[model samples]
Target: MRMRASQVLALQSHFESTFTHRLKVFLAERLPEARGALAGEEGLARLEARISVARSLGFRGERDACKYVTLSFLLGEDFHEAHWAAAALVDPRHRTPTDRAEALWNAAKQRELDEFTTESVRASD
Candidate 1:
């Protein structure tokens, strides 16, 4: 489901450590109902677009995007796309150097996960 711009803004407003904790709970509450509605590439694309919009609207931090991407991936969305999106959002040009480094680290880890998932999928096929 495409989240409204206003809803995204609301999320950004609460992008703090406390809010992050709360958001996790919020997602946990809604995940079961929403997970089945989003599947495959379409779901991945929507999530990427949502993060893009959040950034464009001045959400200038990696944590929230990272959390969202992590949650989405855990919920069976495309981890590869989510990983890249999170990486790009925290890129040095877009965020602090420390954040960039962290994002790069996360990107590397996600890449590893992606490779594993790809290999596993191929094996299954």
Candidate 2:
């Protein structure tokens, strides 16, 4: 079934509001904490700490929650990568949306899964 342009646009808007917008806000707010966590601990301690921070934001949907969790793992890494990447990430920047979204994709791909994610994979195996 093909989606109409209107439906596609609406879905885009929904993701913008629910996942992207909230994530950017949360990242901005908790950046320092995320940076701190980079050096604090590893394994479940760091992963759970990131999830705990996400829970504090009150996101309540499957897609949003999934994004939050994945991003929780990637945020610190993404921040550092984006700092050096060709993607110019800042306000009043060219292609901010594309740049940021692409950065997240790269981050997700490059992330080293925490114990929770690894356990799920192992369980499935």
Candidate 3:
């Protein structure tokens, strides 16, 4: 699905909130090269395009695509290539360090998952 402009802005906000200036600059340097590769042809190309532009400018990779996707979920946002690229850069599983924003997002996401799991278990029972 095509992402709304508001959603794009929100993702940008999250991206900015999650990284430091130095990391942002480093990501900016690497982003242009990874743009197309990161944003594969899929749902919401325009929204993905906007995110690619943001990453091209200076968005840091948090780890790999999967972790980024997880982070996006944790943030209560849709997954995008920029998040994946950021995740790839940080290697979220092993050595990725999270800031306060990431921590908050993660906590919220874990709570949501826990709720879902609990509901599912209760249903099965």
What overall lDDT goes with each candidate model?
0.55, 0.49, 0.46
User: Which of 1 and 3 is ahead in TM-score?
Assistant: 1
lDDT of 2 by residue, 7-43 (tens): 9999988874555345434554666555444443353
Considering every candidate listed, which one attains the maximal TM-score?
Answer: 1
Off by over 4 Å in 1: 1-30, 66-125
| Alpha-carbon RMSD to native, per candidate | 12.4, 13.4, 15.8
- Candidate 3 to truth, TM: 0.28
**How do the residues 1-125 of candidate 1 rate in per-residue lDDT, one tens digit apiece?**
89999999878776643443443445546665655434455644555565554455345466645554444445444443464755565455755544543554466567779999999999999
The true-versus-predicted C-alpha distance at residue 13 of model 2, in Å, is 33
What's model 1's TM-score? 0.29
The lDDT-based order of candidates, best leading, equals 1, 2, 3
Clashes of each: 0, 0, 10
Q: What is the C-alpha local distance difference test score of candidate 1?
A: 0.55
Worst 10 residues of 1 by lDDT: 16-25
Q: Model 3 over residues 1-125: C-alpha lDDT tens digits? A: 89999999999888755443333344334555443433434423433443454344233354432233334433423332344334544444534333422543464566668889999999999
